[model samples]
Target: MDKSNHVEINGDRFVHRLKELTDAEKQCLESQNMRIIPKLKAAKLEKDAKRHWDIFYKRNETKFFRDRHWTTREFQELINFDPDERIFYLELGCGVGNMIFPLVEEGFSNFYFYACDFSPRAVEFVKRNKLYDDNRMKAFCADLTTDDLFDSVTENSVDLASLIFVLSAIDPTHWSHVATVAYKALKPGGMLLFRDYGRYDMAQLRFKAGHKISDNFYMRQDGTRSYYFTEEELLKLFMETGFEIIMNTYVQRRTVNFKEGIDVPRIFVQGKYRKPLEGKSISTCEG
Candidate 1:
């Protein structure tokens, strides 16, 4: 199929495509299309995300993402470190220290958290947070797509790193660069956890015609942008960059409204990749 062009799905064209498709394939396509409404809503969410930190901090400051109360449960379980060991945690695209603040307050000290984002607003927000301290937390603004993270983090020093819904916002072509940086920055056996939008996700099907900012990328009315990914594409990008997958799962979450009699399904691909220990083959384990 020609990915460059959009698929038109009016009544006649839809019926034609249905005739050509097998029953199972037709069902899948219908499922994907069912996400159009949610996708449109999510697209509108992009505007708020474009100058996300700026608008958020201006109005609410650090209180916006303060629900870091959930970070220890959601993020900490992925770390392979002992709480007593001095660990280095780096969050690429760490906007406003949402995860950092929660982790610190959870009493997980003896760790240095290096947080960075490309947005200056994000950097300032992190710096201004009450939990931020030079001794334990460091915040900076850097574009991970093209810049070198080594200037901010020592090579092979990080014990745990997270991408957390950040990479899908970047141009897909730059995913390899982001993976390369993560590979170089993590210590042997260190973990890289990722959570991002998956292909056929409601967000992808919501795009109206002519919304293309580039192939596989679209801008929502809200000014934030997102790219969708398949498991195959995501696995290939990380593995080719010298990391081995440990856990890769396509997570499906559905929100149901009884009053509206509608079900909103959201899909995300979450993966954990680890840098190989010296002399250890990258292929021996699976993510």
Candidate 2:
């Protein structure tokens, strides 16, 4: 077995709380910002973000991402419902069916999944999967930043929306639009589950000078971009978008390679927010 790829969440080497960066790590981050990507290059990357992701899938296919077996563990909401209750679940960036197919195999027959991705190649991969059933899942390609998710998903009809590792890949300028789209597609009381990279994670610290694209955002070696978020800013973004925060916090995990004797910290921001019921009145004073 390959212990080299082992990743343990809240593992023995790391605490679950927010990680304070060491002086060296802080200095490395400062150095990363010294030579940012040129304006012309940054603009072109933003304009052709979809193309890069399409190429990513064209090369890696479904093999790049492992099936997400941790969804139920992290989000008990998936199993909290009655076995017979129909869940109109939407996965905002369902990459190659990595997150949805596992649920299907787990016998979530009641969830009718609507999965979308920015890359057409990724969506096609989802559709071609052996577990994909027309009755259980509907996979398509849509740029959540600009394309209307409601074109395929009915407005105010979704029961749950998961944006796992999705928002970070988008430019900060369009984040609000994506949030608004998710809110519109969800029922008034529907929940949105989000998990994304957090500030000063190992990956962010490793980037060398010249990749920075605005504050806390950078381009990866493959041309795909990622933005690290602070929990406060992320929560504020959703709250301002009309979601009432249920929970928001940073999660620290460790990736360990015993064979190679390596252990590194990973930081992520996880949140759950709910859309307030329409026309619900608030009382000024408590009883």
Candidate 3:
């Protein structure tokens, strides 16, 4: 048996239970025709996403998402960690330590944090933070699609992973690869927490005419890419790759623009999935 196949789950020998899906379920997944958007075709979209970040950070920098303290609340609620339960946590696309800083301040210091982002500027922002230290938190600059996270973490060792508002930024076609990589890195029974723009989000609708890069995916004027996902699509993607969802909810957030005197309605999909124990298949009841 491959050493990587054996994972430690809550201090126990974790094993893989890759169950065969029912024919009906397999057909349902196949009918959806999910695919990776090729990089060559997605080049413009990627460029657009990068441009959006450049402008966004230039103007707002650390103040952007940091002001929205609700993220910390959401993360705490999702993980529900005990005070003394030490765990290994990884934040994929962790920009500027906004989430990490708050997690530390809340006295949740029973874990190691590995944070990575594709942008050097973003990593630099995290590194410069006075609150960040090398002992408890390690920040790296790498693209999740191609970079190796195991260089910073042991294989099959992470307990929880967070992909908050990150996946939608990448080309939808690459998401499966990301999922596979994440699955390989996490321990059996480990959890994956995600929150991202759902299909028809206010931001997606805000795209100007000709901003349609692909179906249900768009490019912001600032060079950032986004994909709005449906609940069915999200469920099938993860479950197909071997995860059992614990919670999946579509949250509607209405942002009142006091400055513009308009209301912006946004929809976000949030989910928590757990890796199944060895020889035990996960139930797809929620899907």
Candidate 4:
């Protein structure tokens, strides 16, 4: 069973629980399929993706996203490693060190962290954090959809890699490239952890028609884009990139606030994949 608990942020208690979506929620999502952003605008958004993310970080700094403390609990591989064992852990699209900092604070000294983001501002934020140690971690800017990640992280060298809420930020057409790059970066038997917005997720359903860039993909008012995923499609993406699926499923949660009289159901897809211990080298690029 998935964990459900009451979390208090800024003194207001929010209850989160596992719950299926109600019919009304399903209807709202269906409504989003009627329209999408115009082609020229969508193309421009894709081309200026990095600039938008740069502005996002410049405006929000490190306040928008909370540090991720749930990863160690959700992914046992993170905590299973020996404290002194040397493991190369790579975080693709690591925004502001939200995920890596928590692990460092929790005493994961065994990890040699390599983190990258599309926005240079985001990487600067990570580097400026007090906990960032050059000897233990390398924070850089790289677009996973291209060969930039390979320039910093050698092929077949990473022991663990994570794509937490990262893939959705990328355009679906280049998803194959992201997977291929990750596949090439990991050592045989290395693991990749993934979590991202799921189809019919609250955020996806909330998008007005004009915001839709394509099916399950949308642009926010700030110009940043998101692509919601289904468990089947996400699994197929990594599998076709030559990864062995360990687990893949949807995580459903309901956020409820009594004072605000608000209740929203959220959905996310999470998965774990591993490179085969013995196999031919995974090929680069698909179509």
Candidate 5:
């Protein structure tokens, strides 16, 4: 006899189990885990990293993601722009103007946008978009993790920098360097807004043991890698890089999968960190 999937001890509709796992299920789960060839993993990760991203852009082009329509709505910091005042904005790992186009459409006219992506094709997509304007939005292609971003953008420049779902794509060790660039690139008192995968997120939990690149890093079959972060970890990263925290919060949403009789929880870490206005001068780093 099969047991019930839900319990009603308190007259509440609650799910007791995700599903029953058989021995076959366990075997299949194990098979789905990531398998790294220990000796070649590092080399493979290095060589294929850029290529995989290139291929991803080539495959999906501009259709991969929807414009982030909720940006201004979700975070009110982006609003209250004055038409006469000029606000310089920089976006790292900007993908197809998802954040840019939306903010522009919302009439943040005073803000000039500088968007860069490692993938040339992705940059091209941004430049070619219907919403793109040379006078307002500039698109460039460069590897931010190892590139001198100042060459493309001005030094001590932008009033705001955004890293939306971008950091997870990078190697964890390189984040300090990433922060350095954003720090030096921003005007004193400028803010960096961040959002990325959070620790124990469903996406992280779904990965099998073999796919675990490190404690919280993993690679997908598509050759893309992601790192899930804890609130503490993220705080430390930005704090060490000379940013003062404004707001750090985790957002959780539960989506019910009626077909599978399961509830999938998605967790994301969002933050606003600012550089001190009256402090030391920003240091420059070479690529």
Candidate 6:
């Protein structure tokens, strides 16, 4: 861990908690700067969101995003199992195999991976990756916010389901449905790995006026949208949807401009939520 990114919560190094900052940093947070929804077009754009993401992939061709190399570092349990142990892994919004490929290539190959995304192009890229193997990994297109993940896998077959930076891309109003699907796809005692944009993050604070779709929700210039989540909201959502939070903490880092000698802190909330040994039925939980 870099010294600048080091933060301890409750005497634990990786536990998630809101950060306390100096007066200057606090002033820089700018949590009160939500913009007005300039045009109702944002609503229509959000409704037709699949098109925007499809176009985003077409134009960028996977160049805009970097492969995530931090999953194993942050979630040691994913790679700590015996080499022969059988694991069923599902990653919602698996994008371009950033989390999946690294775990498999770097010694977590004893698992069956089911990765899904809404964009067909993104799914194709994952399939075309040289590291992707059909026998061990399956990348498909599905929208869990409105569809069940089990449509591509057997019920309760997954050991771990990850939603890395994916949930916030969805419309906030539909998150309950997404949670229900994730819970349904996992076996009893299965875990859901979550890491997403935290409230008052630098990215959230950088949004311009007229792009706001809702409080802490905004449509970017490219038509894709995001929601900044607070820890309280995540806790309530997980507990109500039959999850018990195991490791909950925030990751914060300060980036400096050496020439100007200015620093800015970036915050992201990460958590591990476990399904109960006796799980809740979708009917009762979603109700």
**lDDT digits (tens) for residues 1-287 of candidate 3:** 12455444233232222223457645543433345345564685565555556566667679878433565555554357686787888888898787778777766678788898877678888888988889898898666776477677676788898888898988887788788777777888888888888765656555554456677776565567778877677788888888887766565556777899988656677777788877778876432
Instruction: Estimate every model's Cα lDDT from 0 to 1.
Output: 0.69, 0.84, 0.71, 0.85, 0.76, 0.78
For model 4, the local distance difference test gives: 0.85
Which structure is stronger by lDDT: 1 or 5?
Answer: 5
Q: Which ten-residue region of model 5 has the weakest summed lDDT?
A: 8-17
| lDDT tens readout by residue for model 1, 1-287 | 12232233221010101012356644654554433435554445543454654565466665644354534444444444676788888999888888778778777787899998877787897898788899998898777876557778899999889898889877666789999888888999898878777666666666765455555566555455778766677778888887887766555555567999979766667678889998888762433
Candidate 5 global lDDT: 0.76
Q: After superposition, how far is residue 122 of candidate 6 from its true place, in Å?
A: 0.3
Worst 10 residues of 4 by lDDT: 9-18
- What is candidate 6's lDDT per residue for 163-247, written digit by digit as tens? 9998899987788888888988898988898998777777877676677777778888898998988777887788788787776
lDDT of 5 by residue, 124-239 (tens): 88988898999988898767687568788877888899999999988887899898888888988888888888766677667765665665678777778898877678778888
Q: Pairs clashing in candidate 6?
A: 15-249, 16-248, 16-249, 16-250
Model 6: which ten-residue window has the lowest total lDDT? 278-287
Q: How close is candidate 6 to the true structure, as a TM-score?
A: 0.85
Candidate 3, superposed: residue stretches over 4 Å from native: 1-59, 71-79, 257-262, 285-287
Off by over 4 Å in 6: 1-35, 254-263, 279-287
For model 1, what is the alpha-carbon lDDT of residue 80? 46
Which of candidates 3 and 4 reaches a greater lDDT?
4
Tell me how many residue pairs clash in candidate 3.
Answer: 11
Query: Between prediction 2 and prediction 3, which has the larger TM-score?
Result: 2
